[model samples]
Target: MTTTGAVLRIQLLGPVRAWRDGAETALGPPKQRAVLSLLASRPGDVMGVENIVDAVWGSDVPRTAVNGVHTYVAGLRRALEPGRAGRSSGAVLTSESGGYCLRVDPADVDVTLFHRALHAARRSRGQGEAGAALRLYGQALSYWRGEALSAVPGPFATMERDRLRDLRLTVVEEWAADMLAAGHHAELVTELPAAVSEEPLREKLRWLLILALYRSGRRAHALWLYEETRDLLARELGIEPGADLRTLHEHILTGHPELLAPGAGSPLPVYPGGLPPGTPGPVRLPPVGRDFVGRTEELARLEEVMRGESARGGPTTPVVVVGGTAGVGKTALVLQLAHRLVDRFPDGQLYADLRGADPERGPASAAHALEQLLGGLGVDGARVPADSAARTALYRSLLRGRRVLVVLDDAHSAEQVRPLIPRGPSGVLATSRRYLGELAARDGARLETVGPLTAREGTRLLAMLSGRRLDERGPAAERLVALCGGLPLPLRVVAQWLAANPGAPLGALLEQHPALRTRFGPAEAADGVPTGQFHVIETS
Candidate 1:
């Protein structure tokens, strides 16, 4: 297919509308718009008829789905390439290998242009040209008019809408951060409140707005806004303001000079990966087990979510809560994920034991956790704040503009985790016995539930840890895996036992140590064991 001289401009950042040669093209019915929406999502990629059907109709597909797609394509072809003659193969929307491909100049598509502008903005920001970055960010964000793909009916449209909306929000936050860094707080004071209203739960937005208000000499209003935000978060999400907001409030209250100084704070950092060699920063991550295995999906998901903050070039911190029953490897999974993401966060990695579920001492207070985190960040113990809120504020202030990964282990509640969340482009990986739903609802945290490994994974872990060819043991290994309930703690303990008792067969080991059997009894064994066969024998 050859490209026509005329350009077809498709806008998917907002309502799925299109224009050809500066003329508005009437996209047909909702389903047809959905077809175009899907095609436009992956502009050059070929979408098979079956794939289109699945995306458009979801599960309730009709027998005539293929024909419906063909009709939609025919309609789109007519609208997109009006000059094409009748009964002719489409020049723009061409059929290829039993699928359809939408060929268009990427610059003509709003989404592509938006991303290009974002890339340029990111580059400018990286080079410390805050003005140029802000201009580029504004240009990129101007493409968004309303909810993306609005009223376009299809599963694909719904998902794409959500994705594009999130991207727009990220760009907006980055733009505001740049604006603030450029000392344009007076302008943002009137503007950011609406954005905050639209995304009330976004702490980054609230943080920027509060900062703008404070810098605009509206310290009282900023303090009032913090109280309002606190009350709102408490009422809606049952949580307190996150570290960033709390820190800003403290600065406002204490009349911190940094808040009032020119060049108030630098723009958020944009490190692609590791910092240069000899960039000294604390690496406090706990060593992960050498025999760590499984949770491939969970780990991948965590990395994706954590990296997504930087990938979007936004100032929002990514907080991920890894939750499950005790002894199910929540902390292990978080530590593994943190170790994997260390290079991505160039500032450093910080770890703290909240001891939320510790038997000897109850959950560590937020103040103590903040002190530990601040000390890990190289803040002297003597200089740490005496007040809890002041400590949280100071901790977040230290984290601002730095790409650090703060791993909060065994968190007791959302409140405990909230004060510890890092600010700016940093990331947080928190493990908790409780679900900590408030983090997700209030902080935009991604909740990942860590569970026991599958039988195959357990067997692999055992084989790796014990230096045993457990695959050779077949049903006995399977029985042991079931008996361990696939939890890492019990499996590691048994693997260690087998490592010590080298030649003991798996069945004989079970017979020889009745205490081991009692501890890791059958999956149905009840006493002290939680549901899902979680023994709760020890802390993760």
Candidate 2:
């Protein structure tokens, strides 16, 4: 006989809910909730009748409590297995050994999924793939909608709640590390302060904020972060910063090169070839540009920086900065570089859009980026600090010695990218529309400017994208290149339009679509290319 796929799920940690399939089952009485909570905690593990009685009644057990417990268990079994309530399928709650056990898969329990994600994220870190590891951790922590067992009552719920809370702190530490790896230092400045306030005992988080402050060029603020964290740790935990944190503070105070070093941080965890436990399914990247072309010189420069060795020796990685005008292929070049360097940074590569120059809202704060990065690192929500300084310090500490590639895409300026710089010997690549002159002068950074592709390059790119032999198309291909302004972005956009409208003739497309003319405006327009298409083409 085929077994029913039905399983009981209790969520007391957040809002309380119990269900089998789409049907709701009433968990009768206070004791019934308690019984369910107990079984849920140790699903598949048999609990003796006496242990269940004590867990429910504690020291206030009554003479007839045994009979009441049995009645409650029987009712729960019926409610859980409504279809097999009276059948001999022996499913739902099963009789085992001396007592009974809830025979349910660990994934059926929310707590189990949460723990599995956390563990898997940790394992990813162990494998030196910090970027993938952080994402897994964040996915796992997101499963929690609210407090653990929020609807459940009794001692069992209370105990499990505390345990999950403790696990949250470890998650926070991992998250801080990931943010630092991802180059979100400026954003962390705002968040670390709040994190420290919320988690006063976590000295590691305070150190993270300090590092963020220092790297963001707020030397005083960075120092202040250390002082505040030190004070809080002393008053609350009656302890001092851990060895790693203390060392980081000294490095900051003495102006250690490692503090200013590119990608100087711990290696984040890596994904181990499967969806983290409890995830609905595999996480997939969204569809981005496919007809990407040109920017070869820019890509080569980024590749050199990513592969360059640290001058200070001891496995130091180089830092490369790419700056240019809007629509100049900065993002494209960096992304391409990241893909190429994937094998080198086996720990995994991380990318974040800093939005430094956004006209509307200010650039994303370092703290916010840190929070997201930390979440990716498997740091639990409850454990993440409310203070920015703590978060940065924790971030730096985590990166003390790991090889990972971090790409900070669309940065506004050097300050925005500073604190987010990792410390160890890993690689860091940043792209921005504005020139970060000071960063190059002060930090020994290599700046590469990306402009329009060469004519030959543009024609080659068009031919490759069109999937037709350029030699065969000859003049037609040249006309198409002339129509694109030699700008990769526009070329790719036009190429995609062509690929999608395969049946349409090129001459007809050029005649009907005003964008084709506008894209190659007067500045770069060839003698015969139209300008109206440039105006018509929407480049969002």
The most accurate candidate by TM-score is 1
lDDT (10s digit) by residue, model 1, range 1-540: 128777688988778898887889999999999998888877888999999999999999999999999999999999988889897867788898989999887777788888999999999999999889999998998888888899988888888888887788888899998888787888998888878888888888889888887677554346556766887899999999988788786666445566763654642221111122234667899898777888989889889888877667566688998877666788889898899898899878899999997888999999999878877755656656688876776566556567788999988999888988866788888987777777899888988766788999888888877777466257767776777788888888877888888877667865654565567554433223234665545423
The digit string of per-residue lDDT tens for model 2 on 492-539 reads 666667777788877876674465665545332312322222321346
The residue ranges of model 2 lying beyond 4 angstroms of the native Cα positions read 1-297, 311-317, 357-362, 467-473, 512-514, 517-537
Q: List the residue pairs that clash in candidate 1.
A: 247-393
The 10 consecutive residues of candidate 1 with the worst lDDT sum are 267-276
- Candidate 1 global CA lDDT score: 0.79
